[model samples]
Target chain A: MTKERKPKPVFIEGAISAEFIGNSIAKHQSKTTIGAHDIFLGQVRADQIEGKTVKAIEYTAYEDMANSKFHDIREATFKKFNLTCMHIYHSLGTVKAGEICLFVFVSSPRRVDVFNAIEYLVNTIKEQVPIFGKEIFEDQSHQWKVNS
Target chain B: MTLKIKYFGMLAEITQCEEETLSFSKGTAADLLKVLFEKHPILEEKEFQIAQNQTFISNDSIISNAEIVLLPPFAGG
Candidate 1:
């Protein structure tokens, strides 16, 4: 039996920009009556927790694991729902506060699938991927970020 | 065979190291974790995730005694 190849995680060190993600979304759109597109952009916020001001975010991942998870999620999503195309992009390395960290784009023939697909993609990424983010404070103190 | 195990975030702090390789038989992923957690008791209290050959696996995922990556709860956008 042939072994299946695992998918690769799209890793970008530093920041995620709207233009970069927008271009990726554009490529998936087809001329065939594609009517709806839904997008979710996760931006880092400069927040003071306790006594520290979060200055930036540093993201890292088990690349091999993250990519594999992405592929599985992609396949499962396609099977569970009908969709035209989906794209997921997340930031690696250092991302300053107020910069985007995660961008998810989905397009479909109708509006309904796009909404559901975006939510599913975002949630699955949060719940499944092995990517981690470290919150760097202005004072140089750091903490790991976890989705609540 | 020996496999590398990695720690992240708070788990890394608790473990006091980022990565280490330990010996194991050709066992499933769960078996490796059982031994690791026993040696590092803090892991038992914390919730974490596992990735075998860079792919995320459920706790019950059938993993051979190959290299695996361990991760804690991640916080990313």
Candidate 2:
């Protein structure tokens, strides 16, 4: 006899909500030896750049590609680090300049790997994900976000 | 064969459209890019990258005759 297992769909949702993220984290937890939890929330900054006031941000993504890349990132993180659970959420569509664009939460049995894993997952997501955000200035001018 | 190519970021600006179909034979993605650059000279120094489906491709890598997608620098946070 043989058994087959289907991979869980990579939890990807593009919405402008924080409650959804909180719920995701709640569901990911189980009765395991989880000792540490670390989270990184990226908020949109209202800043003055070149004499322009920032307005809202428009986010776009290659949906199919982004989903697949996220799956790979999740798998790689699990393989490279010891973690109890992890969740990554990013907003799409329009987000105001003072809104959040991304959130990453990682939990592990110990604290050491959680920190490194969080950093790695976040860095990789920024470097590899096929997502773009346009920073709309108050004057209606626009600029693309560049990862530096 | 015709390769359905998609563009993003500044590359989309240079192409003047989000996507287009190009007639290209089985060759490296760089070749198609070179041809694209020839037609659109503004893409010469745009600082971009490429990906065939889900896999990242180097500048000199060969692209299959099948449909391929081109991507620019990522900005996902």
Candidate 3:
């Protein structure tokens, strides 16, 4: 029989702090089977658009749908790679430029599994998830950001 | 059928509201979008994708009267 696992909630209120990420690593120390850990942190960039600088990104999502999509990604990663554990965190509100907005953590007993898994997870999340970001400008003007 | 339509990101800016229940008589996803276009002409110039009942659908897909969400290009990283 397959064990049913509840999907881990991934949305953070604002920017993901460095302390929280550190704590996540600390908590994983007890999982001795994990010999390697790979992490991907998405930091917001300050882009100059049409003579205006981007101040921050205000993120929003169809929450129920996003959560389910994340679960689907997790399942696919597990099926495609031999992983001991995985975690994903994404900011739901305003994240200032240079702050972390998305974090993906994966652990495996072998180094190669995590290297490939991280790239796959990040790309899939960007391409498949429904999360949206509004790039807020310094002067309060804003524009929608699309993944390219 | 009254369909619950949700707007996200820049699309919400065009719609001027996050969500609303619109009475849509029988039609495909594209047909319902024609109604939205009449309500908000600006949406006609924007790019986005449609998801019915949380699953992405093509514009020509038949509507099953489920919750429809209009998503602009994804920017999440």
Top candidate (DockQ): 3
Report the lDDT tens digits of candidate 2 across residue range B1-77: 87777777667866797888878876777778788888778878777767675677887788874656667778787
| Candidate that beats the other on TM-score, 2 or 3, i.e. the better one | 3
The lDDT values for all models are 0.79, 0.77, 0.92
**Model 3 deviation from the true structure expressed as Cα RMSD, one decimal place:** 1.2
Error of 1 at A126 (Å): 0.7
- List candidate 2 segments past 4 Å from native: A1-16, A28-32
Compose the digit string of candidate 1's lDDT tens values, residues A104-125: 8777899999888888888889
- Pick the winner on TM-score between candidates 1 and 2: 2
Could you tell me the TM-score of candidate 1?
A: 0.81
**What DockQ do the predictions score, one after another?**
0.61, 0.73, 0.89
Runs off by more than 4 Å, candidate 3: A1-3
TM-score of each: 0.81, 0.87, 0.96
Q: Give per-candidate clash totals.
A: 4, 3, 0
State which candidate has the highest lDDT: 3
CA error at residue B34 for candidate 1, angstroms: 7.3
Looking at model 2, residue A22 earns an lDDT score of 74
- DockQ, candidate 2, comes to 0.73
TM-score of chain A of each: 0.89, 0.84, 0.97
